[model samples]
Every structure is written in structure tokens, then in C-alpha cells.
Target chain A: MGTVEFAGVSKTFGGKTVVQALAEVDLRIGEGEFVALLGPSGCGKSTLLNILAGFEQLTSGSVRFDSRAISNPGPDRGVVFQEASLLPWLTVWDNVVFGPKVQGVARSIYEPKAEAILKIVGLEGFKKALPVQLSGGMRQRVGIARVLVMEPRALLMDEPFGALDAQTRLSMQQLLLDVWQKLKTTVLFVTHDIDEAILLADRVCVMSARPGRISREIPITLPRPRSIDDLTNPAFIQFKAAIMTEMRGAHGAH
Target chain B: MPLAGQLSSSLLAFILPVSLIAFWQLSGTNGVIFGGALPTPDRVWTAWVNWAFGTPTFGLNPYVGTWLQNVIFSAERVAKGFLVAIATGVPLGIAIGWSRLFAKLVDPTIQWLRPVPITAWLPISIAIFGIRDFGAIFLITLGAFYPIVINATQGARAVDKNWIRAAQMMGASQAATLWRVVLPAAMPSIFTGLRIGLGIGWTAVIVAEMVAVKSGLGYVLWDAYYVGRMDIVLADMVSIGLLGYLSDRLIVALSGWLLTWHRLQSFNQ
Candidate 1:
């Protein structure tokens, strides 16, 4: 169980001709809650996520995870990069075991868990295959599996499925829904896709670009154990329409 | 991928070399070419056979049965020099690439010194090391080191930032990240450096032996040329080419074995 808190977080880049990527953004996620930071390109949603992940530092304010200040990226927060970013040299099994091996966890403890996670991700047969050998969706599955094997307190994903085809994207969405339902870990998902945010997150925070800020927070009250089928639900459509109007309003303000 | 395709591809590669050899054989008259200065292919072959098989005549003929010994001497020098290059160049390259302070301290000096050719270093090398095996080895090492270090630095610098971040997020320590992530990520570039370094190593060894040492194929080539044994000179040149080609093939085979994943990766892409 992990909670996140950010207060008055502001970020500026470049020494000359300063670019304010983020502007005093304040947000929080309760333990085990899934929150999507929804926005358009350059909305600083990814920057916000990066600050939380400790990949980048904020110019002001602070970010805390489970009451601890975030300083360096650690196994407690697993990041799924937009490109899936699996080390191409490692086999799937090697990739899954990398975190445990690096952390010096006992093989007796991690081997079975690694195997179990691979099975959950439907990569049991691809344990020996290199990431290059897998399709984009399969590689992303390995990426998720590799992270899940760490049993992190939070999953920080940056546009994880933004590159997939529509069909593969839906299947991945269902997979994530199933996995999230079981794990109940805190997740901070960043995505520009409206349907993705609506379908995945417990709450959607719509953001504005150019001096990025979260302008609205809309709670998703859709039924649990949701899948892609929920994407077509009348309630989902209504929520999507409301969020679209809110997004347009924020876009105009920007 | 099939047997026939493989054979046809190999045959196509050999066409130019085989044609050139036939042309040389046709142009030569009485086992001589260009006013007896150059030996024909058959004469070069006979000289090589005698160099390999002829018994020593109380050390009068340097070429007699000493072919294997000279080849071994040159090969050993290359091996030692290349190993030294790897030992010093790789770590230094990584250090320069990974750290700003180290790069600032060491990189400028390296760049300033690099343009001075290995051949140009021979006089200083002999003066410092004094006409010995280490001098030859030193020259070879210096020659090989530049390419290896530069390539390794480039490789290390070019590693994807996300891989490092991913490793850190997965709980890798700084040393572990360098070893497991940066090193492997830099491997493709490092291998490129190694191939280039090795080619330079061969060139340096030949030049070193030609001047600073009295053994190896390079020494033999110069010695035979001075004595008007153009046959032995031609044989030694061919021998050097053969050794260089074989050594290169060995590196290629090793690269293939080590980089199986990279091959599959680029193929998939």
C-alpha cells in the first residue's frame, strides 16, 4: 500500500529562454487507488510523473511516496516507459529476473514468483525469447511482467499503450484491468488517450498544456472488474462526453 | 539461408579475387613479371612450401623451417598488444564517457595525442624501450589503443538514457548499472572498435618488426628484400595477408557468438 502527494510542484527547463513545463501543480493519490493524469501533448503530465518517479527534480515544492520524500528512482516505483524499453539483449526470463537479481534476492524466493508473473502475463512460452523476438504488445507485456515481479508499491506508466494498434490496445487494456483488479497497487498512469483514461483510472485529472497544470479531477464510479466492454457502456460514454467538455474548457484557458 | 543460396553467395564473393589471380598468372612469363622484380603466383607458392618445409642449413637461410616460428612470434605480439589495448582502453573509455570530470581531465589530452600516427611513434618507442620485443608490443598497443578507446567512449556515451533509469528503478547500484547495463549497451560499439583496433594492430606489428625488431614476418620481408630473395619476400607478404585474414575471421566468429542477440535484434527491426 502506497500513497503519493505533490504540493506546489513547479518545473522550469533551460537556462536561457526559460520554459515552465509545470506550474505549481498540486495532486495526490490514495493508497491502492489508480489515477490517470489525462492531458494533451506538452501538458507536463509526463513531467509530473517523472518528478514522482525521481527521474527529474522539481524546481519547487515536493513529492512524497508513502510519506517518504522521492529523491531517487527505486524498486518501490516501477516505471513502464512509452516504448516498453526492455533491454534488447536480455531474454524474457532474464528480463523478469533482473530486478530480483540486482537486488540480491534469494533465487529460492524470486524464481517461483517470476515464473508465476510470466504465466499471468501469458509469456510462459516466451521465457527464452529476446525482447526483439516479441511483438510490441508482447514486449510491453514483458515490461509489465518484469516490473510486477518486483511487487512495487506503485506502477508509474507513461503512455504504455499509446503505440499499439487498436486491436492490441484493447487486449492490453483488458489485461491491465485484470491485473490491477488482482494487485490493487497504486498506479499513476499518464495518457493523452481519453478512452484509456476513462477505462483504466479510478479518477481522471484533466490537464492543460504550456505551463502545465491539472485543471479538473473527475472521479470514475464505473463498476469494478471492468474490461474493454465497459468502454461501450452508456455510463462510460456519458463520462467520456463530460470529460471531453472539461478538457475543451481547459484547452481554451491554455 | 538454404545450402544452395549460401554456396552461390560465397561463389559470387570469390569471383573478383579468382579473376585477378588468373590474370596475374596469364601475364607472367617464365615465373617473372615486370623485369623479374615480381614473382608469379606459382613461384610464390613454391617459395612458401620450401620456407615451410626446408631444413635449416646452419642458420644461413633465415626462411628455412622458420616460417612457423616467425608466424608464431608475430601472432604472439599481436595477441599481447591487443590484450593490453583492451585492458587499458575499455576502462579509460568508460571512465571518460561516464564522468564529466574524468572526460575533461583525460579526453583533451587523448584527442591531442591521437593524430600522431603509430609509425611516427617508432623512434620514441625504440628510444624508450630499446629495440626489444616490448618496443614492438608497445607500438602495437599504442596503435590499437586509439580506435578501441574512441569507439568505446562513443559506445558508452550513446547508451539509451532510459536503460540507465530502468536499471536504477529496478534497484541497481551505480557499479552494477555500469557493469550490467552500460557495458552491455556499449558492446556493439565496443566490438566495432575492436575490429578497427585489430586491423591497426596488424599494421603496427608489421611496421614495428620492419624497423625495431629482428623477427616476425615483417622482419623476414625486409630481410629477404635486402638479400634480393624476392621469392621469400613475396612468400612473406602472402603469409602476412593470410595471417591477417585468418585473425580477422577469428574476431568475426567471436563477435557472432557474443552478439547473437544483437543480430536477431537488428534482423527483427
Candidate 2:
């Protein structure tokens, strides 16, 4: 149900001088497929995700989600920001239930769903705590939980764990893997980290900066039920080596 | 937050005022000062006692036993005006901040009117509503509206873009987003405007009463001065200050309770 397509999409920022953020970027993800846009900073990967999330206007071309042209953000496609961006005034429970509550879902229905999602995200104990009181990783858990509670068809995550410490990031990665393995929601993840892209996605679309475009698309053939332990697997290392080489070549072209 | 600490902090605040009162008293002779033009602290206290508790003797002394009535008059006017300001200003300010079209339509008019001080509006208010409670209220509302609306606009404008996006992504309609997300997020700034607005409300009420209304602390202040009752005038001045201080504390207390999240943020910093 979560098919997405971007056809000849382009975006430009206007000022005294115009800067093209994306130029004729084309991509597609099948239902329940996990795809990551991997690139260095300023590669417009986040811009692409923002456009698909209905938060940005493409200068040209069209984006379709579930065969419908995107007009505005809605519950069908949930976005997890890098900074978590949970409303600071709201507690964990309120943040998780915000989507359903605003969408006018009955309390009888969304309340249990919210409770279950909180438990899944391991934040039932912290449901009453405000966002400011939480650690960065814990806040990101709430971010994921809030989106998941909406039961979205697709998840667009923009470097959801990029701000965490290494150890915290690994745990969060595993948490996401565990959650995604069960839900199998279509995900369009944006990140600059090569290892993260390889570890999580079914296909990695490598992007290059300066009129950002997808330079290469590599399919990860690793078996499912993945874990952090897969990071050391020889097959994962081989994929990483090839991607690193491709990334270097992409960088050299610019 | 300890009891002892809180008590000591409050007591510390009183020391300077107490010493100032003592100095004022000592510098005076026979409860009078400044060649008998000004009354001493003791005289002002005695006047307050009479004004508050003395029996009214059929217009013999208008100031006697009338303190509470005048206080209520002024406070009620301020309250009504401030409420009107909030009712009109908050929504208008939010609209101005949230919608560019609305801002374009209304914001320039408000800005043009803002620099015209409340004192300047008094003649127009008197001309329009002349010598009535509404006249006083109009002045107070005008006085309070600018700060309230400007601050609320700022609060609404400064709302984090991501918060709005998050709400949008959650399937919130534009109205729901403004109410649920923009309103709550703008609260801290709204409180700031309320405080400033209330202060101006007090000033406006005083100005309105002294000129247009026949009763209230401001009327009593000007009347007591005219009748050569320096003690009543001093007491009235002190009464106005006390009322203003109490009302400001009321707003601060309300903001403290409503903005506990904001308080926690500052504490963390």
C-alpha cells in the first residue's frame, strides 16, 4: 500500500542568485520496500525526503505516494526528524497520541494503540515526562513511537539517529531494525553515514552534491532479520567497500 | 524552595522598604513634611485606616470608609478592559502571525495606531463615550492592546516550523494546528504580553478615572489633592501601587502555573 514514485523532480532556492538543490531526481520504491538515500552533507537527500513528505515544493515534476499525488503531509506517511522534534511541552504519551487525537480518532481506539506503541518503543515508564527531560536517544524513541502509533503506510526518516553518541546510535539502530522487521513499513531513509545506509536499507541510492542527483543505486542482498552483528559480516564489508569506492568516485566527479 | 529560604528571600525584599519608610517618618515632624504640604508615613497610615473603616457621615468626608469601593471601581475597570484586550488582541495577533494575507490586511493598521499613546487616546475616548465606565474601559483596552497584540504576534510568528510540520503530518487541519500546536507553543510569549498589557491596563484605568470617571483610586487621588487632604492623596497613591503590584503578582502566578514546561526549560539552562 506504500508505493512511492518521484518523476523528474527538481527544486531550486531563489534569491539574488539561484541555487539548484535537486535536478531531475527520479526514484521509486515498491510497497513495503526500505530505501535509503546515502550521500555526504548538502547532497539534497533530506530535501528529497522533505519533498516526498509534502513539506517542500518541487520546482518541477511530480511525487506520488500510494498512487496519489502528494499535496500535504498526512497520517499515511510519517516523518521522523533528525532532532526528534517532539513538542517540548508535551509528554511522551501526548506526543505519541498527537496524530490520532488530531485526526479525531476515537479515544477508545487510539488510547490502547498509543499505549502499545509506547511499550514497543520502551517508553511506557517515561510517558509522563516532557521531551526536555529525556536523553537524545530516548527522545528519538518517542519520535518513532509517535509515528508508529499513527500506523503510517510509509516512514520517511531523516538521519533519525545522527545526533546520538556511537553506543546510543547502535542501540537506536537495533531498536529501529527490531521495529521495522515486525512492521515492514515502506521507509525512505535519508542519511550521510555509509554503514547506516548499508545496514538498514534494501536499496541504497547514493547521491552527489552541487545540483544533487542520484549517482548510483546499489541493492543490498543481505539476508533479513538483520542486527548490529551484521556490521562485522564479511558480506557486509564487501558491500561497504564497493559503496565507499563508488562514493569516492562520485565525490571525484564533482 | 525551602521554607526558610523562601521566607528569608521575602524578608530581604522588605528591608529596603522598611528602612525607607523609617527614614521618611524620621525626617518629618508632627506627621507632616515639606513645610506641611506632604504628610508623614504615620499620617498616611492613619488616613488609610479611616478611609477603610471609618463610618460615612452623610457626605461629611467623601474619603472616609470609601477606600474599598474606589479600589473595587478601579480594579473592575482594569479587569474589564484587560479582558477585552485579550479577547480582541490574541486572536488577531495569532492571525497576523500565522497568515501572511491577514498580516498584510491588518498589521499595518495596528502598527500605525500603536504609537499613539493611551494618554493621547483619552480625549477621543471621552468624546466618544464621555464620562462613563465604557470610556474608562475604552482607554484601558487601547492602552493594553498594543503590547498584548504585538507580543502575541511575535509568539505566534516565532513558533517552530517543525512543530507545525509535525502537526500537519499528523493529519491536523489548519485550524486544529493553530489551536493545538501554534497556540500552546506561543503561550510563553502570550504570558509576556499579558504582563505588559496588565501593567498598561492599570495605567490606563488611572488616567481614565482621573479625567472621565467620577469614582476609583485615580479619581480619589486627584480629588484628595484638590481638597488639601495630603494624607488621603498619599494613601491613595500607595493604594494604587499596592493594587498594581498585587495584580502583577497574580499574572506572574498564573503564568508560572500555566507555563511549567517553560519554567523547566529555564531551570535546565
Candidate 3:
């Protein structure tokens, strides 16, 4: 049910000068699989994710989720924004429960689920705190918790930990790895960090900028239940080296 | 300590007005000023006390014990008009901000008409409602509507794009998004509009009462002036100012309570 397919997808943002953001991008994500679209800035990775999330329209080609043509954003696919973007006015509890409340899920049904999700994200004590009152990492935890409460079939995360400090980023990565290990939701993670892409994703699709297209797809055979410690593993290092060379070659060709 | 600091700050703010009143009182000769064209602050105070507390003698003094009544009249008019402005302006503004088609259809008309002052509407209001409370109410509504509507539109338009996208992604219907996400996000802006709109409401009530109505503080202001009761005129002017200030305080307090999150956000920044 979490399957996603992008068939020859092309997107051009039209203005006085038309900018082609993506061209002939073909990709597929299987149910419960983790994929990362790894690229440099301006590689249209975000645009691609936005298209798949139904936040933007592709000019040509098609995107499908669960074998149906993607149209508008829905609870079936949850998106985690880079900024966390928790409703500034809502407390962590309100933000987490926002999805179920809006979808008319009975309070008796969603209340326990929300509490459990918040605990999973390590934000049980922060339920009463407003987003602004929390630190950046705490806010992101609320962000992840809010999405997790929805129990979406697929998770679309766009540079979710890009704004965190080095230490905070590592902790957040570990938290995510722990959570994703249990849930195993189909994930389409976009990131510029090579190690992050390798550590989190099963398959890393390296993308090139300027009419963004996948330059290479490297499969990561890292052991399951991976932790931040695996980042220094020799096997992980080897994969990173190969992907780095692929990125350099792709940039040179451009 | 915080309470003491607040008290001192408030007292500091009153220094200018207090000193101004003192100077005016000291400069007056026999409770008159500007060669008897204006009354001194003391004379205005005396007149105000009489106007507020004097027994009704059924005499020629129209303002005898009528201060509270006139104050109520003006306050009531402002309240009614301001409410109508909020009722219509908020929804209309939200629609204008949310939908491109709605904005294109209605925005130009509002922009064209907004610059036409509330005073300009006085003749039309009187012609229609005829020297009654409705005329003043109409003007007040017109005056308040522009700021409220404009601010609300700006507030709705300024809502973060990701907020809407997030709502949609979370299975919120379009209507639900507008109600829950867009409305709340636009709240700070809506409060801004309400404050500006309310200030205009006071101005409108005075202008309308001076021209189109026979009761209220504004009517008394003009009536006292014509009879050369400059003491009552000054007293009436003070009454209006006090009311305006109080009403504005009410709105500020309301916004403070409703927008606690927004307040925390600014403090964090």
C-alpha cells in the first residue's frame, strides 16, 4: 500500500524565463522500503518530494502511490518539513493530535495513540509546551511525533535534521533510526548529507542538478537495526566513498 | 517587584498629561482661557461633575445629569457598529485572502471605495437612515470595516504556506484547513485589524453624532460649543478620549489573551 512510482516525471516552473526543475525522472519506492534522494542544493530533490507529496504538480509524466495517480496531499502520505513547521500557537500535544482531530478520528481512539507516539518521540513531557518555547531539536521531535501519530503508509521527509547542530543531528538520526526500525514505513528521505543518506536509507539515489535527474542508485547492504555508531563502519565508509565519486563525476559532466 | 515596576511605568506615562493639565489650570483666569473662548481645566472638571451628578431640574440645561447617558449612547453606537464590521469584515477578508478568484472579484471594489472617508458617507447615511442612530451606526461600521477587513485580508494572506500544506497532508479537508489552520494562523493579523478598526469606530461615532444624530457625546460636543458652554465642550471631549482609550485597552487585552502563542513567539525572537 505504501508503493510509489514516478514515471518519466518532468516539472518546469514557468515565469518570464522558464526553469526546468526536473526532467525524465523515473523512480520507484516499494512498500516498507527506505529510499533517499541524495543531491546537492538546487538538485530539485525537494521539488521531486513535493510533487510526490501532492504539494506540486509535474508538468509532464506521472506520479502514483499505491498504484493510483497522485493528486492531492492526504493522510496516506505524511510529510515532515525541514523547519518542523509545528503550528506556532499549538502545544506539542495539540500539534501531534492535529491530524486525528482534523480527520474526525474519535477522541477515544486517537488520544492513547497520540500519547504513545509522543512518548516514542521522547516528547511526553513537552505536551503542554508551545513550539516556540521548545528548542530546535524538541520542535523537530514534535514534528516527527505529529506525523507518526497519523500512522501514514509512507513518510516523505525533506531535510528533516538539516537545521540541527552536529551533536543534536546525531541524536535525532539515532532517534529516527530507532523509530523507523520498528515502523518500517515506506520512506522517501531527501538530504544533501552523504553519511546521513547512507545511514538511513536502503537505497541512495544520487541526483545531479540543472534539470535534475538521478545519476546513480547505490544500494546499501548495511545491517538492520542500524545505529549512529554504524556511521563509522568500514562498509558504510566504502559506500560513502563510492557515492562521493559518483557525485563528483556527475557535477563534472554538468 | 514586577508590579511595582509596572506601577512606576504607568505613573511615568501620566506625567505629561498631568503636567499639561496643571499648566492649563495655572494659566487660567477665573476658570476661563483664550480670552473666555475656552474654559480652564478646573472649569471643565466642575462642569463634568455637575453634568454627571446634578439632579434633573427640568430646566434649560440639557446636559444636567446627562453625561452618563450620552457616554452610553456613543459607546453603544461604537459597539454595535464595530461588531457589525467584525462580523462582515472578518469572513470577507478571509475569503479575499484565501481565494484568488474571490480576491479578484471583490478586492478592487474595496480598494476603490476604502479611500472615500467615512465623513463623505454621512450625507448618504443621513439621507437613508434619517438623523437617527442608524446613520451614526452606518458611518461607524463603514469607518471600522476598512481597517478590519484590510488587516484581516493581510493576515489571511500572510499565513505560512507550509501550514496549509501540512494540514492537507494530515487529511484535513479544505474547509477544515481554512477553519483550523488558516483562521488561527491569521489571528494575529485579525487582532491588528480589530484594534485599528475600533479606533476608526470612535472617530466615526463622533463625526456621525456631530452631524446626523441628536444624542451621544459628539452631539453634546457640538451643542455645548454652539451655546458657548466651553466647559461642557471640554468635558465632553475628555469623555470621548477616555472612552476611546478604554475601548482600545479592551482590544489589546483581548488580543493578549487570545494570542498568547504569538506573544511568546515575538519574545523568543
- Per-residue lDDT of B237 in model 3: 89
Question: On residues A1-254, what C-alpha lDDT tens digit does candidate 2 reach at each position?
Answer: 99999999999999998989999999999999999999999989999999999999899999999889998988999999999989988888899999999898999999999889888888889989999899999999999999999999999999999999999999999999999999999999999988999999999999999999999999999999999999999999999999999999999999
- The list of candidate 2 runs beyond 4 A from truth reads B1-6, B30-33
In the range B64-157, model 1's lDDT, one tens digit per residue, is: 7889999999999999999999999999998888888999999999999999999999999999988799999999899999989998899889
Q: Which candidate number has the best DockQ? A: 3
Ranking according to DockQ, highest score first: 3, 1, 2
Q: Go through the candidates in order and give each one's DockQ.
A: 0.83, 0.83, 0.91
Model 1, position B217: C-alpha lDDT score: 92
Off by over 4 Å in 1: B30-33
Measured on C-alpha atoms, candidate 1 has an lDDT of: 0.92
All candidates: interface RMSD:
0.8, 0.8, 0.6
lDDT string for model 3 (A91-170, tens) is 88999999999999999999999989988888888889999999899999998988999999999999999999989999
Estimated TM-score for each candidate: 0.98, 0.97, 0.98
Candidate 1's displacement at residue B48, Å, is 0.3
RMSD of 1: 1.3
Predicted complex 3: DockQ: 0.91
User: lDDT score, residue B147, model 3?
Assistant: 87
Quote the chain B TM-score of every prediction. Answer: 0.96, 0.96, 0.96
Q: How would you encode candidate 3's per-residue C-alpha lDDT over B150-245 as one tens digit per residue?
A: 988998999999999999999999899989988899999999999989999999999999999999999999999998899998999889989999
